[model samples]
Target: MELFVDLQIASENQADLPSLTLIEQWVCIAIDAGSSKTRKEAELTVRIVDSEESQQLNGDFRAKYKPTNVLSFPFQNPPGITLPLLGDLVICKQVVEKEAMEQNKSLNAHWAHMLIHGTLHLLGYDHIIEEDAVEMESLETKLVLQLGFPAPYNEQE
Candidate 1:
């Protein structure tokens, strides 16, 4: 599978952001574990922004007026158009860093989790319902563990 990741840094603080290679690897891992298609070409963007942009997007799209860790916007193609576009993931660098520090997790590990979670969202995995949450969280744990990171949910809870 050929995957393209467009990394966009809109945040002034680039302190703990992961590299494009690591971001691509995390996205690929999630896609491989969640997507049904194996050999299709896909592209996604990872846009890192400050809390203000994140809060605006969250308020606009989700109606929550707070800065969120990550927001996934899945691309919806027209009926007859088959594009390789997956979607865009807007991550709040400040929130993520604060979360990592609060959760006592490595910066890279949390970043990987966010990317994997967002990519899974792009592939139609969600945690709104209990069953789906279990499935999605289980897959996420498996993938994160495979990457040698601590279990994210356990730490969060």
Candidate 2:
């Protein structure tokens, strides 16, 4: 539970949707939910950006010309440094809020889910394939629920 979150607010868009404490909490939940204990004392960066910035990064890095709710960039440490830097997470506040409203999810819950999702991605969990998707999504659901949030992928009623 000794994780440190370096929060960076690059945009004055959304009233700091997920406060630093909440971000750290969800990141810790996701990290602790993992099988490896290596990330017990990890470090990562969380940047809140505008839609334009998100779209730029997404397009440049992922070849997608849209703003994503959350994007994860895992760190690749060099040979000598023992820094426990995991990676970075870029969150688009506008997209997150819009998605929450559209998906009928509580703003905070969706924020927590997105933060958890990005943290898991930093921890090397992905839904690129069927099996990996199941495992990653299941883990996300369990962690979110344990953190007092509803299942993120529940069918919209």
Candidate 3:
């Protein structure tokens, strides 16, 4: 899989973040892990924002009022349009940082999990159902592990 990412940093507090190239590699690894059978070019946008922006977007798009870690907006290209665009991932810096600290995980590791999670969602993976959740989580574990990161759902990570 070939993946291209357009990164946007809307967070005012320019905290340290993984390089854009690294993020692109992570996303490609995730997409490949989830759909190795297909050969396609993928494009996506990754936006890093503050909690307030996350909250507003969550409320507007997901009907939730609170800020979450990551939100995926899969593109809705019409029936005939054949753009390789996958979707947009809106990530909250503050929430991710807090969650990592509270969960006793490294920021980079947690970010890797979020990136994989969101990218999988873009690749048509859903976790709302128990079985699907297990499948998606399993794939995430494998992908992150390949990158030398621990399984996200494992407590010992």
Q: How much lDDT does each candidate structure score?
A: 0.94, 0.88, 0.89
RMSD of 1: 1.0
Candidate 3 lDDT by residue in tens digits, 42-142: 89999999999999999999899999999999998999897888899999999999988988879899999999999999889998999999899999998
Candidate with top lDDT is 1
Task: Tell me each candidate's TM-score.
Answer: 0.97, 0.93, 0.94
Report the C-alpha lDDT of model 1 over 7-111, residue by residue, as the tens digit: 999999787679999999999999999987774788999999999999999999999999999999999999999899999999999999999999999999999
Please state the error at residue 104 of candidate 2 in Å.
0.6
User: Is 2 or 3 the stronger prediction by TM-score?
Assistant: 3
- Candidate 2 per-residue lDDT, tens place, 10-100, comes to 9876674777888888888888886366554889999999999999999999999999999999998898877778899999999989988
User: Least lDDT summed over 10 consecutive residues: which range in candidate 1?
Assistant: 148-157
Q: What lDDT would candidate 1 get against the real structure?
A: 0.94
2 or 3: which has the higher lDDT? Answer: 3
What TM-score should be assigned to candidate 2? 0.93
- Point out where model 1 deviates above 4 Å: none
Model 2, position 72, has a per-residue lDDT of 99
> Residue 32 in model 3: shift from native, Å?
0.8
